[model samples]
Target: MTHDPTDQYLPRGEFSFLSLSIGAMIRVLYYRLRGMRPVRVGHCKQCGACCRNLHLFHRGKWIQTRRQFKRMIAECPEYERFEIMDDPGMLLLFSCRFLSEDNICQDYENRPSACLEYPTLDLHLRSKVLYPNCGYSFKMVKDFGKTMKAVAHIQEQAEDKEDADE
Candidate 1:
C-alpha cells in the first residue's frame, strides 16, 4: 500500500472528548483481549529533543493552518508556551518556549501533563515512532506466543464449561 506523508498529520477520527476517551478505552481493551501489553523502558536523557521538536494536535487533527493554530491557542491559553517553527503545508511544527539552552525545561516543575508523561503508553499502542536518539523504548509485557496460547486455553475452558452446562 502506498503511504501518504500527510496521513500522519490526519486525525484517527472526528475529535470529541467522548470519542477520544472511548478510543483510548478501546485501545486498552484490545490489548487486554489479545493478552498483550506494552511496557515503557528507560528514562529521559535530557536531550531536549521532545521539547524542541513537537507536532501539535488540535480538535481532532494536526494543526494544518495558522487560523486553526490561532483558534487552538485561543481555546488553550497554556498552549501559548509553544511557538510555531514551521508550516510544511501538511503540518505545523512547534517548539517549547521554556526549553533552555542547556537542554532543560525552564518550567519543568509546572510543565504540562504531556511533558511529564512523555512517551505515554498510547504512543506505544499506536506504534508512534520516537526520536532516533530518544532514551525511551517499549517492549512487550509478555511473549506473544505464550500470551496467545494462554488466551486460547482460557477460551477453550469457557467453551467446555458451556458444553457441560448444556
Candidate 2:
C-alpha cells in the first residue's frame, strides 16, 4: 500500500538507525529461524518517483526547513547532492541532482546507498509505506503463524510434562 505523505516522518539518529537496523536484523533472524525467507520482488519501473519525492531526516527529526537542510549538508557534505523540492510545512521533500529529465540516474553506478537500497524491507518497516507506482515489493517465503502457534503448543506441553514429573 502507498504511504501517506503526511504520515509521521521517520527519525534519523544514531539510536534510531541502530534500533531500526537491529530490529530488521532480528526480523530476518526470526524468519530464518522459522524457515521463512523474505524475497524481493518486482523490478524498477524507472519512474523517478523515488528520486523526486524523498522524505529526508536529520538529528532525529524530519528536515522541515531549508535551514535545517543546510545544517545537515554542513554536517554531511555528501547530502549536498539532494536539493529541496518542496516543504509542505510538516516535512521537506527532496530530489537528487543526479536524476535526469528522462527519469534516469545521471550517475547510476555511483548513486548513494539510499538510492541503491530504495524499497528495502527495513525502510518499509520504519515508514509502513512505499512510493506510489514504484515497481517493487517484499514478501516472506511462507506464513509462519501456524508454525509459531504449534511451537508454543509444544513448549507448553513440554513444560506441563516437566511439572508433572516434578
Candidate 1, position 70, lDDT: 90
TM-score to true structure, per model: 0.63, 0.59
Candidate 2 Cα misplacement greater than 4 A, ranges: 1-41, 120-128, 138-166
Q: Residues 72-155, candidate 2: write the lDDT tens digits.
A: 989977778898888789778898887778786777655654665566566665566667777766667764666788899999
RMSD each, Å: 10.0, 9.1
Query: How do the residues 54-138 of candidate 1 rate in per-residue lDDT, one tens digit apiece?
Result: 7666665657788988998898877789888988887778889988888867775567645655665554444457778877776
Q: Give candidate 1's error at residue 114 in angstroms.
A: 2.5
Best by TM-score: 1
- Model 1 RMSD in Å is 10.0
* lDDT (Cα) of model 1: 0.65
Report how far off residue 44 is in candidate 1 (Å). 1.0
Judged by lDDT, which candidate is best?
2
List the global CA lDDT of all models.
0.65, 0.67
| Candidate 1 lDDT score at position 65 | 84
Candidate 2 lDDT (Cα, whole model)? 0.67
